[model samples]
Target chain A: MSALVTGATGFLGRRLVRLLREDGLQVTCLVRPSSDIEPLRQAVGDALWSGVDVRTVELMDENGCREALLGCSVVYHLAAGLSGSTSTLFLNSVIPTRRLMAASVSAGVQRFVLVSSLGVYGTQTLPPGTVLDERSPVDPHPHLRDPYTFSKVVQERVAWDAYKASGLPLVVVRPGVIIGPGRGVLSSRVGLRLGPLMVRMGGGQQLPYTYVDNCAAAVRQAGLAERAEGQVFNVVDDDLPTAKELLRLCRKAGAGVKSAWVPRPLVQPLAGAYEWYHHWSRGQLPGVITRYRTAAMWKPLQYVNDKAKAGLPWRPEVPFDEAFRRSLTIAPAIG
Target chain B: MTTSPSDMIRVALVGCGQIADAHLQEIRKIPSAETVAVCDVHQDFADQAAARFEVPRAFDDMQRMLSEASPDVVHLTTPAHTHCRLATELLQAGVHVYVEKPFTVDVREAEAVLEAAHAEDRSVCLGHDQLFDPSWVQCRAMVQAGAVGDVTHVESVLGYPFSGQFGRQVATDRNHWVRKLPGGLFQNTISHPLYRITEFLTDDRPALHANWFAGSADVSIPTELVAHFRGEQVTGNLLFSTRIEPQRITRVYGTHGALEVDLDAQLVRRSRQNRLPGAFEKLEMPLRHCREATGNLCRNVWRFLKSDIHYFAGMRCLFEEFYASVRSGSPPPIPYEGMLRVTRLMEAMFEQCREREEAGDTAPRHSQERIKVESDHTIKSDQRSNQRPVTTNRDESRELQEAWS
Candidate 1:
């Protein structure tokens, strides 16, 4: 069997490709024309790399993308623009997807799996103690949203739109905050670094973060399982750790440094000041206070994966504590 | 190495450490520069370097390589402390020299190297190659072209990645060579930004002020520093740290506008004064920055796609310039006076630090005692020599202006 995968250069895409290869499927990776493949080569190992084929196309090139997807059985649409303004987000994420999905359909791909984000729920803050499942209502149009969330929201709608209109077998996998290795598991810069400290906000609010490998596994499951077709899945770890607990675990597993907590009220002000300073000084004080993710930072994110658990033969492989510990160490080589 | 053309420059690299690869890789590009020999104190390192670079000769002994290879120039890639002695030896042997930065261990050693360079009547270039970095070159040109109008103040920062293998080694290993330098790791690494900043200010004896914070108990070194340099015309700030993620940035502020030069991203972001009202600036400034950042992103991505970016590109440019000066009898790429002045500035800063320690100001609080914040004036204020020669080097009438793109 042959599988076509987009975003093969991303965090989850690398692992998903590895998983697909291990399953004895020939993998074709649809990479951006200008994307560096050295990282992909490093991620997928040289010895067993013969089974994988990487094709480069400008995302806007519909025919090129369609040609790359040709003769492949399954398609995994995992590529996303991480951050951008509204127009850029629409241009990079939405338009590319609308194009790629059209190409996937034209190529008669077996299954189209869309890797979306839990942010589509905008469940960043629900009523206190409210749990969210796949069927729960989502904000039709999320407001005051970060470009990432807004883009993911719009991208998911596009995927579902294609599914309803074109009868394309699509599965939407919405993953929570992915905590992975400090280096090389996903994005080169993403991961839990051994910083001198892990500063937590919102006084130990519950956070819906998933271990990266587990999230990758869930995504892989969503792609392969027939029952996952035309359905939505919320992928997260079994237990959502509180911000304080996460920080404590990070300090223990990470640089073994001090842990500090800024109260909920103060976080907003800090973020506001940081925003003003960032604009006024042009990032002279970077990563100091961060963007006004005050709402996301302050509110508790409680995601329920019951639908995914019932539908797919997958469970959270790594628990919260183990995931936290593994994030601090070098990721084990998995075949 | 193959037989060279009459104008071909035969180069031998001494000290086959990590940096030697950069030199070897870059030397392959220049048609006239042929790397004839590789040398290191360790025989295995010499052999490995020679095989790696496909050079004709490898030797554990520098003298043996110099005599046998008879190269036009010897690149001194050894530890900073060893630079003075080795450079002097090569210069005395009537060979042109290029030493990696910290040019030498301290002021005295730099002076000795300077004297040797003059005595041999040979060119000696310090590897402050960021001088030729396209980004910095563009930045300096902008300053000259009044892009940032009358450069009033400049700040340059050097950040080390202490979380990686090399960084972890530097953090844990107290016996590392960097820890043994006069100013410890700062003396070893600060030369990068210090020289970059010195290029603009051109003051021989700039006033120095510095504050440091201990990184951690395990590191056993003060890994964070903020140093200010007040000059004749430009006020400068130097931020040095091993705490932050590895970054090199130089921001120049002027009366009309300001520009931030990012070495990592390889771009310059020029910011003009926002003419909007105070309340509206909150909205407009961010939008303006977004415009500049996005514009730079598109440009840099295009450049990258065109294969315009290369690691050690600055090193390659400097090597070319150094070889050019060697081929011609032009003044050296890095003037001897600027080299010595950088060293003197470093020495002066360390001198004040020592004076503070002797003054019984131990356990200085971060809030209270910013010990070496010198406000009055320069060291050797009245009797400053080496000023004119370096100032002339910084003038617009240099040969380096033409080499820049």
Candidate 2:
């Protein structure tokens, strides 16, 4: 199968493009005009890079997107704006997806795989340990969340709208926070980074993490598998470590991370206090630890990947311990 | 509380959303104004607002509330597009109107609303509240009194935080009313800065040039804007940015000195050439700045003690002025001519930006070229001085490390 991959220069996109090229697919890498492709070329090596058709096209260019999408049966859209103002996020993330979907449908692409985030799910109000599967509803009030999550929610909505409107075969893969080399284990799930101190919210909550390589593998399978069309897959590794255990492992590896742990029971009240102070002080303090954000990020919920295992018929190749070790080896030791 | 029921102005409010809280709270502070009825398309919002503010009645329909409560003045706090239609209707119903700004979508809508107000012989006020802040009042007084002689130039900067309630709502919703505006989110907010310029640059039609850019990867609409206005007498520059730290300030430069009014801090300062000779001038300037800072600090503390240092202090001043004008049969606090002038200038500015965007030239190509020129000059300078090569790579590496962390 031939595939067109956007965000091919990103951390996860590089591995995904490499895996697809190895599988002998004619892959066309769509990149932004201002993107630096040297790192991607180095990651894939000169031999594979030479074979890959690299196209620098703006996602907003409808005609260019259609032309680049031609002859590619499957498209993997992994590009997303991680942080920006609301307008920036929408323009960068959501508008491009809408345009790309239109182009994909016009170019007769068979399946479009959208790489979304697990953060799009509205699990704040759900009881603890609730099995958050593919059937769980997306955030209805995404505007209340961070701009990145809001954009992802809107982008996913646009993709699904395209699927329903144009009959463009679609399979979405919502991966948990992708962690590997170049990215450390410290995530929002663990705590807020208040200057140098990491205010770890709760320790017992399991971190929903997917190794970049494993995520890439599942994404590749999502494009190739016969039963994957019209399905949503949550890509998460089988074994996971709680926030406390991850911190323990990091310290054991001689990464002296600065952290203060808030017990699980005290998380809500502390967040309430922060929120109250944020409002009472007339925004002198940043509204980073609101009850809504705290509930969304630090909630103790069970994430199920049964749909991905059955639908894509894929498994995470790298074990959690092996992935953790690989990631820490390259990451700078926390000061 | 001071005014009797018969003498008080019966005020009704439309659009009981986030900004309505500020309106109601400020109106309550004015004894002459009583919020009689509140209305919203969302019944829950109207009901909640009524309960919170202790308004007499609430209505989902504005027309019903207008007829039953019979308010003397109405605050049209609805969305921008709805302003022209609603304001005209309210005027025809024999009620004065106070519109939350971006008074109407375009110059044509603004003119129509103004005409309707004239025909009905009822006063209309545009919510250019920032100009009424104590700091701005002081700055304007200084300019009029020739502290800053013959206002030659003006600069206004309005920095919006996208994380704020209104910004978040617009940013997250694709079909938001703001996105439908001619200049997108800029249309809704550019007025505040533009109005400040219009106060000095009173030319009905200014030669305008604007450059709009997305600035960041996350927004498609122009979040950063730089516009220039060359009026009949004064030159003006406006910087409306979302990426910067939130601030609202305006600086006016005249022949004698410059005045800067920091709206957020409710502080005003003046800059002029030092009178002291040579080396003593340097010391004198710092001492003067220190004295000015101390004075401003004291003033702010006093205002805070009097419970006047508020996010909506300017709005409170605006409300008091408008209500006083209404009661005394004076022209509206914000003149229709000034409102129309700003709206007209805004139209021209947004049009210039739209034309540029349509030409497919939204990228920061100018900055790129400037960087190239500067780098070439630096390389030549370094060779001439026999110094080590410039350290661009180290800065890039450090930036990358910071981003990674």
Candidate 3:
């Protein structure tokens, strides 16, 4: 079998490419013309590097996108513009997906996996004890519609659009914040001198976090699993950690960061003020507090990743604690 | 560490960048001010700055400097992005803060600092140098005095010559903080012009139309922009370009007259209708021009003699005013409300530019209205999805950095 991956230079793309190669399949990497290939090379060391084939395509160029998917039986689209205004998000994400999907369908690709984000749910502020699962509608709050989330929502729509139009056999994997080697939310902020204490917004709700390798494995499985076609899975850790516990673990990971949680009641008003400001600013200025982010961090619930577990062979093989520990051990600040 | 009430206002400088030297140069001249320490992330920069400026202490660590120096004021001359976190931290520590421009990266960050300052009852000064520039001060006074009648429109333009080392750095460095900002080149350089026009406009939600173009087909990064704006009572255009000779010109058009300010030359020219016969009007214009030319020369020479025309002199004046407010318990040198208004305008301009770039033929034209127009959607989804709660941090860890509560 042959596999082609867009966003092959990104965090997950690198791992998935290696996974395919390890499975003894020919893998081709389709990257943007100017993408930094260093991370990809670092992810797959020298031995596997020589056999890898590379192709460059402009996402917006329909012909180029089509040409890039040639000779691949399975196509994985993992690239999306993570930032910019609403229009920028649409251009970078939705438009590219449409072009890529059309191209993949024409090239007779059997499976297409869209590496979507769990953020498509917007800032999910469920009731205190509500657990979210695949049955939970992929709903995003109106007020929480920044370009990043809005783009993801639209990109998923585009993928489904292609699926319905061309029967492209699309599977979407909405991964949580993918904590991986040489990259981490908490630690990359070291340069900002955030100091050694992490504050839990809204006194500790469940954060839907997934380690990078687990997410990659799930994505690889999504492409291979016959049952995953036309399905969406929320890829997250097995033992969902509370915001408070996560920070405590962060401290133990040689980060030397401690934890402080502000009671939910006290933080709610501040988050509301920030939401108002974000709208008034027209999504230009992001506030430290957002009602959406506050709700997510204080929801007092865990995410259920049952769909991916049941339908696909991929499980949370690496526990969050071990994965996190190993990641920090390799690169304390970078990860 | 503590300070006596009778002692000079202890001050420490942070982030020994290009602007830190300006603060150090001016800060030392204040009678009640004492430059107790200087600090930077780089030790050599801190040590060299402290030694060069004859400061008594130097430290690479911020907390240690704050702990050891116990300075009443900390000048934050760091990049725009760092303002929110660092300023909030300083404000919590109960130190007066003087931050360099664009104030904070966005309005919320600006509000964050203000909230912290209000919470701690500390002072925060924005490094809006034009607000204190001698030529700008004179022009502003004239505008207030009706030298330009009822101001209706403004054209604020700045030209940059990308020929210097710093210019080359901005041109080449892909990882530059300016490149990371929303407006890219405009974010780095357009604050002055944005504030110039924003000052003349009201705080009502503005309607903006901005378009940008690069110098050549090979240059993809925008080096030129035209931001047309409509506020409640005024309209303005902010023009910026790197292809032109260096000049800062802010012209105000009014019902009765016009005021043209040359910021680089420290000159202001005013024009009014002669209200005479046609031939007499033609004669009056040149006479007015000649008189204005002589006045400009005189003003320039006088300012040079008095050292008011030197670089960063406005910064010095602004700092002195900030100190006055800190000592007298008065309103901030830059009104918090006005600063917000300026930030709004700046962000609006960036939004317009980005909107034009990404918005193609299909997207609905951005409508201009006041607060909270219900955003209409083009793509339909299940109605249940509308009620879905907000979920963040899907694929992006970079945007998930928590602002310390």
Best by lDDT: 2
lDDT by residue (B228-253, candidate 3, tens digit) is 88877799988887878888899998
Candidate 3, residue B107: how far the Cα is off, in Å: 36
Interface RMSD (Cα, Å) for model 1: 22.8
Candidate 2, residues B1-405, lDDT tens digits: the string is 367777788899998766787798779877788899999875545755676568989999988999999999999998898999999999999999999988898989998998998899999999999888778888888889999899999999999978775787677666678989887898888899888988999887888889898878887677889999898899999998888888998999999999998888888998999999999998998999999999999988886656556777678889888888888889988988988888887788888888889997666766446456555665578668966444457654344334334
lDDT of 1 by residue, B300-404 (tens): 788665656765779889999999899998988888889988899888876665565466442345421231131112223423642312224333323223322
Higher-ranked by TM-score: 2 or 3: 2
- Is 2 or 3 the stronger prediction by lDDT? 2
The top-ranked prediction according to TM-score is 2
* Tens-digit lDDT track of model 2 for A168-242: 999999999999988977888888887878888888888899999999999999999996788899999978998
The sequence of per-residue lDDT tens digits that candidate 3 reaches over residues A1-335 is 88888889987899988887777777888876567788888777777877678877676667886776777788889988775444335556777787788788888788999999876763364567677776666654422444466668767877888899889899889998788667654521111124555555553566677888899999999889987788988899888676666666766655665555566676778778767865454333434456665554445665889888988767988998788776677664733
Sliding window of 10 residues with minimal summed lDDT for model 1 chain A: A184-193
What is the fnat score of candidate 3?
Answer: 0.00
Span of ten consecutive residues with least summed lDDT in model 3 chain A:
A185-194
Candidate 1 lDDT: 0.75
